[model samples]
Target: MKILKNILKIFGILGILFFFWAAFVYFSFDKTEFLKTFQSRYSKVLYDRNGELLSVFLNQEDQWHIQAREIPQRLKIAVINYEDRNFYSHKGVDFLALLRALKNNIFLNQRTGASTISMQTIKLWDKKNRTYLNKLNEMIQSFALENHFTKEEILRLYLSNAPYGRNLVGFESAILFYFDKNPKNLTWAQAALLAVLPNQPGLIHLEKNKNLLLKKRDLLLKKLYDKKIIEKDIFELSLKEPLPHFKTHKNIAPHLALKLLSEDKKQVVSSIDKKLQIKFENKALEFAQGLKQKGIQNLAIILADTQTYKILAYVGSQDFYDLENLGQINGARAKRSEGSTLKPFLFALSIDEGLISPKSILLDVPTFFSNFNPQNANKKYYGLISAEEALQKSLNVPFVSLLQNYGYEKFFYKLKYFLDFKDEDYQKYGLSLILGTKELSLEDLTQLYLGLANYGQIADLSFLRDEPLKGLKTMFSKGSAYLTLQSMKNVQRFGLQNYDKTKIVSWKTGTSYGRKDALALGATPRYTLGVWVGNFNAQANANLYGVSIAGDLFFELLSLLDRLDLEFQMPQDLFNIKLDLMSKYRYDERLGGAYTYTLYPKEAKILRTSPFLKRIYEFQGKEVDSKDENFKDAKIQIKLDLPLNALDFLHQENLNFKSEKNIKILYPKQNLNILLARDFDKQKALVVKIANLKNEKVFWYLNQKLIYEGEATSRILDLKPKIYSLFIISESGESDEVRFEVKQ
Candidate 1:
């Protein structure tokens, strides 16, 4: 008896010492370091401007934990009431509750849990076996947690780490998975449902055990009402609420959401207008479905604000899940050939250079420059057309002629230096560039159009809020951009005719070669939109072209936009002048028949001469020899009477003149080479001309063969493919010769 008493005393003293050591270690543990060493998985979230959830990127652990502040008051009350009624009052372990549980399990043969919220939080952190030793360790850790963190902080850690069935952890993830809503927005019934879920999470299937879940939830609600934590009315209403059904989360703006999520960011706030994006996405899908019936498989649309240059709505593909169409590819960012859509820029540049006015006439007849020959879209020529009319009609020949006159080098330089088109080498794109041979993305094209709408200022587009605005680059003079927009506004098409006439949209359409791509770009003073319809595989669809397909969709989108004032304000430095319709030449009505009003920048230098007289002056200056017989009677005559000031401006510029002698090559230029394909000869013919003197005879020869002798000034020659020497001899013995080659 004495030895047993001594052993008991020694054991009691050792237990007290061990308790003190554990207490010291618990108090000394760093709570922050504990949290840092613990790794809990969480999903990244994407939100739109309205704070609406766009998408959630699931982590490997399938958890979507939120911050503690995101926890709701109702949820906290429900969880505390169900899990531990005295959670706030307990110090790590509730001694009274433990005694009651021990009495029930040992003496009454009934089982009950007495683990406080802090003990459960420690258990979650350790994730160890539920043995007595582990429980003791948890008790020590729980005491440390209670000492270091506030009651609310301990509850937050417990809520964030608790498991809630179906491989989901954390209150946010479980609530979203089961109820499809945030915890803070949960109702009393929802809070009750979540409160009992963690108890038997793995064993209770929502569908199979829904009744069980409802029963447990009701009991928890009763407990809350009995304890006066919830009012009788609220408790009754929560019991009446139906069980929550599992709802799949909606992944809106999936492409953009995934793109932003890929940047490894925890949260992303985009500038997208959710309503507009949804509307445009539906429209794009419907349009693409309709086109698919006609063998077209893909489409994209982008709408941006001209003032801020921020993308408001973007549909990167018609259906991102359509594997057959390769729909995962973002068509808006893909590069493709740009057809006649770029013609307006070319005309704008020419206007800025003071090379041509809107009324300047361009030859639309069959013509060739070097080895290249261009044709109009309709395969028929209008002989001669004004620059403005050609652009409105989208005439190919007129634009090609203008590009030739403007020079390819200058246009290439402007596109590279001014705009940031750095993808293609300059040499790869040729004279066919005016016809849309150069490749460009829809984003690039939209930016260019936005520049035109913003009075020739180009700025980079933004996709996020509070992003720094890009520096503005000048693309065209204000006057030139205005003129281009004016021309585009008058474009004749089915889409434009159907829209509200009061709202002006300066727009252009492009159809790439073989109809592989269809594009339409439109801009108002407030907004800019661009759309493309094509196959991602670069397959051609004959029925799909810009005017009938892309243009129609563009107009439909325009109708959905809110009305804004689109009136253009003319700059103070621009002036209007009258021009002859037939000749496209500036004429004073005081000395002329009829004319149309045309706008020109005040700084622009206009040529003061008739088109006919200008042509004759150029011929005389270049081809007429002073010692030749044709020069003896070559005297310039002023035919039209003019105003004194106009005459003075003309005389100062040395442009008011009409030459009597017209000695020049009208067809083949000096040292020119021509390719003679089988089809080329049918579309084009060679003609030769010499100045006609009074009863003077002219002789023409090809390769020393006297082809004709005529008194007429012009003669058409039927020459075959060969190197030929053509000689023209006047009756006065003045001779000129040209050597040229034609190849098959």
Candidate 2:
């Protein structure tokens, strides 16, 4: 018995000596360094499937921070009453509580602890194992800290800095998140909530144990009353407070906050409303599943607030988690061919280069570019058209010609200026840019689209909270984006605006080969979503155009959000420019070019209504000679003869129709005839139709007061026996009627 007592007394002395040594050591060092050291050991970032941020992943176990002040009086009373009744009166050691714990363990044969809040905090920081020495060291460290910090300071730091589940590590963050406000603002009910988390924050769900929270809160309140911290009335009043009345942590900005909130060691607490993430994520998954079944192997989408650009949801793929190869290749901004969707950029570029204005004339005729001659779908030339008209039709001939004229290098440089890309950005995505030949990820398109939506600003996207991205160059003039937006709203004019029947949705479709397709990284006043639908296996579907797939998908999905209420915001000088507009009628008098070829409107003009038809000529009357007889079918012949050189000149200059006065009149052949209204008014045009002798309708031209009906007998004017059928019409269906004079 004496030996055992001697061993026990020696053990007690050693413990005391060890505690004193630990206290001395802790008092000599800085706490900030200690905190930093703890962080270096553990920190990991979390992200949503769409490459969006979720939060940081930290802690081997769950813990949470709550301000000392935020902890309810009843909560504080409950913890101290159940765990250590002398908590307020003790230094870090809590001698009385330790004695009681020792008696309980010795008598009851169970493990018991008597560490004060200060000692608890000290143990949390210590990485050493939970040996007797480690516990002594924690007690010593707590004692030393007591000299530097007050009881409240120790409590504040302890509550302000504790691991709360994965990544959450500070009281300020926890209180704001849990109570949805500052720690000082936590109500009595909210304060009780914090205590429930310390046992195992993640495992604890207050909602699942409403009775437990109430019971704990009541016990704590009763203890506080017994300890004299609060009166009986106050304790009862606090008990009456609700369980979830304090703020909550439902992370609303799930996607945006994911990127913004994940960072180095520190806690990120913001107004992130993650309450709708489940619904949003589910919807996104549904879209991906639908696309996958249709062989649309890959896709990316982003949902954002229209006014503030705050991202609501981001569904970048059918299943990013399932595919190891997806989203791994594309950076935050995706890269891909823009297809015809890039036309707007070129149109704005042209306006800046002074190559052509909106009203500039463009002959939308069949044009060739190297070996690649492009044509419109309808395959008919619109004789002369304006730049706007060409854009409206998405006419390839004009765009190809315009790009060639603008100088590919110069245009590339211009694009570089707006894109302001790095060498790697270009290397990974080069020549294919202009032709949309290169592949782009969905994010890249979304960023570019952001430039369009933000009125020429390229927002610097980042994934770190408190590290705001800065210093971005302007991609384009506000006027340019504004102009593009306004012009694009006219998709209806081009007959392709059946996209969103519900709202004013402005979008563009890009189809480059079968493997590439896009339905804009576009925005209205409410939301912006960019979608890409294509075979991930590099198989292009000839039948699936960009307009039909991704475009359709985007419209269908966006319609579910709500109607996009937006208007066409036009520029100040919209379509106000002096350009060489095209004219179908040419005026060159010497070559039968009329000084004024009156094309009287169907409606009468007030100034002059007498002459309904006017045909100007370079030669007539006295000029007529031996050329009159050959007039075909007893009809009048109007012709002007010119030198062969002049004919070649007209052909070279593309002035064949310009010199109307010089074209020779032709006569109908074989069974052809004429019905001249000679006594009819010369001021009016007579509708004329002709036919072969078999009575089948044939070619005819309208002439002044001359009408020819099929199968009609030749009708002569007031002139004396005029020879008809003078112009030879061969039996082979070819006719030669040239150089006949007009006798006036």
Q: State each candidate's clash count.
A: 0, 33
Tens-digit lDDT track of model 2 for 374-460: 565346666456656676566666676677755656656655554545433443433334446544456556656666676666664
TM-score of each: 0.74, 0.60
* Best lDDT among the predictions, by candidate number: 1
Where does the lowest 10-residue lDDT sum fall in candidate 2? Answer: 603-612
Looking at model 1, the pairs that clash are: none
Reference-based TM-score, model 2: 0.60
List per-prediction Cα lDDT, in the order shown. 0.75, 0.51
Error of 1 at 626 (Å): 14
Stretches of model 1 off by over 4 angstroms after superposition: 1-40, 61-164, 167-185, 222-234, 356-363, 405-407, 417-424, 495-503, 564-744
User: lDDT of model 2 at residue 367?
Assistant: 41
